[model samples]
Target: MTEMRLTPLQYMERVAAHFGTAPHAVFVSTFGCQQNEADSERLCGMAHAMGYADAATEEEADLILINTCAIREHAELKVLSYLGTLKALKEKKPALLVGVCGCMPAQGHRVEQLKKSYPYVSFTLDPASLDKLPEVICTLLEGGRRRFVTGEENPPIAEGLPCARRVRHKAWVSIMYGCNNFCSYCIVPYVRGRERSRASGDILREVETLVADGCHDITLLGQNVNSYRGDCDFAALMEKIACLPGDFRLRFMTSHPKDVSDRLISVMAEHGDKIAPHFHLPLQSGSNDILARMNRRYTRERYLTTVGKLRAAMPHIALSTDIIVGFPGETEEDFNATLQVIEHVEFDMIYSFLYSPRKGTPAATMEAQVDAAARAARMERLLAVQNDIALRLATPYVDRTVRVLADARGKQEGILAGRTDTNRLVYFAAPEEMIGQFAYVKITRAEPFALRGELINPK
Candidate 1:
């Protein structure tokens, strides 16, 4: 996996000469999802390989790269605003290189207009061109003005590609790339391109290497992980990874409600020792009418059926979800129906957002567009309801002993934090040495968001 697909000989020589002086400092400001964070890690790893050191701040860095997100309009705006601020920095220091990557550059106009708007900006790369980072930076440093390393789709690299992982024990393994389901409101399929899953052998080999390297918690990442059609199906991939010799806990994210199958649930049930029971099946809207309009391809009943199966397979499983409150043409009944689904599902946590239309999406032009004020109110209402639901669902875990993979240090004195198999954040009093290890913890206090716990003897 470390063997790169592309290597320009001239760029390599230039980077070597550039590195002969001092290591270039790189500051990567990552925005959006886990996938982006994972991409950032690879970006850093590539930078590191090219003799770049980590920069503590944007100002201190020789290169300032914003790993952008375009999921919502606000996210995109934030990146643009930041880029505007960087104009001063780029102007002040002629050598200070500014680059943009991720979904923002993938958007057509953003890149086209960026060339004129911010000539100080050194380069713009799309999400697929992550591996090209080394060359991009080298090219920029070598004083070549050919900006925008895009249009050429980056082929899938092997899984063990070196990454400057943010966490010592937790790692993100992207089993697949892109999306096939073009939900009316989504721009992922357009920006990220069609589904291209990584090879199974590469994934497993990566996992094995990670486990050997003291990383034990692994999250399989994708736009829609469940729809993975690599060398094997998603379920089969899980089974293979779960069987691998390791002390690792496995997790996957952002499953499309339509693609999560019974076999996946059964695999989770079978591999209780490894696979964590946290299902994040997004229910965009509960109303069938809205669901149809959104092109989710699954009704409320079908979604519920899958939920029931998951719960039946593992009742203690934490169910999180992505919810959009006010899509085009949504009504009172539609909003209420979403609330009903929230109540019916009793999700452990919810990542909710007010619907913001993307440029190329079908829903953007639809009639009866929701009022901005209504969308805000609906979002507030949805949060309030889900907050109560979260607390109610969390209440049962109080005083229970659960295995926690110590992952973070709590702000509270003498406490270390980790997550339950169900993905509940549990903070327990433990030494710093236990940060990368598993501990049995007895929950002492519970809230909607986290649990305070005391470490107990495993025996």
Candidate 2:
């Protein structure tokens, strides 16, 4: 049987008749950042509304969609590998349909290549067009030929969309979409398009909904969260949210140092008790020349000053950072500068990656190259220094009583895991009933990755 494609409106008309009495099942495998996860929720909601049921496994799915990421070379490679596996499955189940969406499909060349190489892939859609998913799926189900819908139309927030959430207590609320900052090595600005903040009313409504659903923590997700300038802007949004009627904690991520204003810092200081005191500021490079080349728009001195200010306001702030090693034209001197910054800052955690060329970016076309061996050596040295610092920073927490919100069960029996306000992972023995509530725990042992603790008072 040939595949058919139908528009969203068309899909709605034929949904009941096409499925007959049987439910159409869909399986979504999401990869990459929290933004992708939030996008997948809407994707699933669209599928459900189109008379499709959620499948337990890919093999059981009548339709499969891979929400992919293209931030690093490895992420792209993994998507390709998954496609190969799906291709083999398609041979066995000829009626099954597969699709690719999200950041990878936003790239024209990648979409073209997928259409050419994987004829089995029924369609490709961009993240911004996800609300039109029912129409896209309808087109495929109606026996239309393989096609791509890389449309530029931004979809409105599918408010009240149904979701099969992967987590129960913690929910990711997307305050905005896309990125305006085009860092030299990044592909986000090109693929995700320019930044557009969601309306403040919409964001507040979402957070209130999550809290009502018993969600205890909300992480506002974005590429440059501090750059959010909806009607309330970032600082005002944080202040308003902190005052919401709930014992829930608020958190956000991936702040750009250049945009971390004093007003925002003051908001954090005022609501330090309600807001998680953890910041993940990406310091791509420590050398001013390297930062300039990467177009990060912030000097090492400026970054250090911001860190100093944050520490002054919140002394026990748990600082996490992102570092990129082996960027194009990075000299040994430049790499050493990063080490010096790491030493001086003493971050609690670091997400380090070797620079990978991304298509359609200025850095990709640059001529300078670091040898593979040298890059590996530099990464190993960087990790060693970071690990040593992480251990030193974690040791001081031992023997202190900290309030923790239990998130999940631990790997061992009778063990439960939770996070402190600063986002430290603490595992302690507690009953299943206490999993979603707050408890005061005494840290008995400390490790670089997690802390061992016990419930000081069980209610």
lDDT for predicted candidate 1 compared with the true structure:
0.86
Each model's Cα RMSD? 2.8, 2.7
lDDT of 2 by residue, 102-152 (tens): 999998888888988988998888877665677666656777677687766
TM-score each candidate. 0.94, 0.93
lDDT of 1 by residue, 162-223 (tens): 58988789899998888889999998887888788998998998889889989979999998
lDDT of 2 at 418: 95
Q: Give the 10-residue window scoring lowest on summed lDDT in candidate 1.
A: 1-10
Candidate 1: which stretches are off by over 4 Å?
Answer: 1-14, 153-160
| lDDT to native, each model | 0.86, 0.85
Which regions of candidate 2 fall more than 4 Å away from where they truly are? 1-20, 153-160
